[model samples]
Target: MKKWLTIALFIFSSSVLFAQKSVKMHPVIDTAKAKWGKIKIVNGTAMTSSNDIVENINLSKDYSLLVTAIEDAGLTQTFKSKGPITFFAPTNQAFSKLPAGEMDTLLKPSHKYDLNYLITYHAIAGKLTVKDIQRKINANKGEATFRTIAGVILTAKIDVNRNIILIDENGGESVISNFDIQQSNGIMHIVSSVLVPKTKVL
Candidate 1:
């Protein structure tokens, strides 16, 4: 009788410990839900999978360059932090558009400012959805100026057909191909081409 009681007590304690560990090990899903809500615009196709934003991006090959650049810039912690940042994430092709050998140079540890500025320039503070962008354009009479975190003002416009367009200082323009990629801390908008700052327009 004594042996049976001891075994039952041990099993109960073990079960409780396992249950606590399981709860603690659950994946973070709040961020995923926030992303879904933030990116309902530009279509939430990406959010249709698991409700884990980081997990979703990790599973995506299309965002490889963006991921790599973020890692190179040491911005993983910043992006993962408690933010509602709006990221204008460039695709692999966008990075490829960089001048020959420039990408490698920028990725070097010595060129931290260039890489940091380039990445931060693509980000805007706060959580801006596609509708918010459209509304801003309409409020500004079809055009608005957005100041990036890097202190550069970018021109935003909507055409007569309601397509969103961004014009850099160098008279170059790129359309926001994918809008409203929601994340826990912020949102992401995918652009087709890379955005080179006016200072780096050469």
Candidate 2:
């Protein structure tokens, strides 16, 4: 009788432990995991996503600032459009590299057009993979230029290390930190810095 009682208690304790571990999940974490789906690793460094561009940005760990900027610019629907957009998404650290109070100034309601232009300047129409950009650079004699949706020019080149580097119209340089994050509507390449427009939008 005592042996049966001990076995029952052990089973109950194990079940209780399992239940406790199962309940130790946060809503935000769970939601992010659900939305991101499976992350496919390529070349043991790059990651491909299963969600759309906007959903990937919203669910990403490093794109919260970009998400907020998109919202502030009122370009959420623009990003969600059925497009083959090639977005140079800047990480939070990239946004932090801006001059003091610059992002704050851009985020103001009065500067919505400027913010929109700034964000759109990072996006080019059509889905361009890193290989595509590299081929363009080769075809253009080691430099290629693309016009963004905001009507700004972005130059691309392959560095000595073979990393794709983007030069904005203002001569700001941002290297692609991560490439080929595939989405349903397009692809995103993570950039190391914010690409400022040559002139503020009116």
Candidate 3:
């Protein structure tokens, strides 16, 4: 009888542990997982293979300039933090689309503050996936405003083509090219353009 009781307790404990492991902490992540179907696995060290944001960024060919700027700005430790940050990373082509010498100017030592603001404007504090963004847009009646670490607001909306567009304070628009690049500490989404925040959105 005691042996049967011990066996039952062990089964109950194992079942409880399994149930806990199966459940996620956030409903948004769960919904995003379902909506997106599967977590994408890439060949390079871009997203799934790497552990942190900087590694993924450094390994990506598209994000070469961005990674260099991040290092120059001295934000490597910040990116390496144990945060579930959501980063709207812009590609090299996006940086190229900037004003003729804007990229060069921002990289200068005197323009570090500007560069930091520019980069931080692309990041949010949480792991907000594509589905979370969609939900926010719907809840806000087609537009959602996200406050960034740079102390600015970025507006987001879904276009008619079902692509998500991020509108910076300066009115520059960036389309989300790749959605949900997961890292150990955060998530990164590739955007087609760089975002610049205005002093205020009028």
Residue 168, candidate 1: alpha-carbon lDDT: 71
Which residue pairs show collisions in model 2?
Answer: none
Show model 3 residue runs off by greater than 4 Å: 1-46, 199-202
Better of 1 and 3 by TM-score: 3
Tens-digit lDDT track of model 2 for 1-202: 9999999999999999988887785556667658765565422432436667787776656778899899999999888888979999998899999999999999999989989999999999999999999999999999999999998688999899998999988788999988888877788888999998788534
User: What do the candidate models score in CA lDDT, each in turn?
Assistant: 0.74, 0.86, 0.84
lDDT of 2: 0.86
Top lDDT model: 2
Give stretches of model 2 more than 4 Å off.
Answer: 1-38, 41-49, 200-202
Clashing pairs in 3: none
Model 3 is weakest, by summed lDDT over 10 consecutive residues, at 41-50
Candidates sorted by lDDT, descending order?
Answer: 2, 3, 1
lDDT of 1 at 60: 66
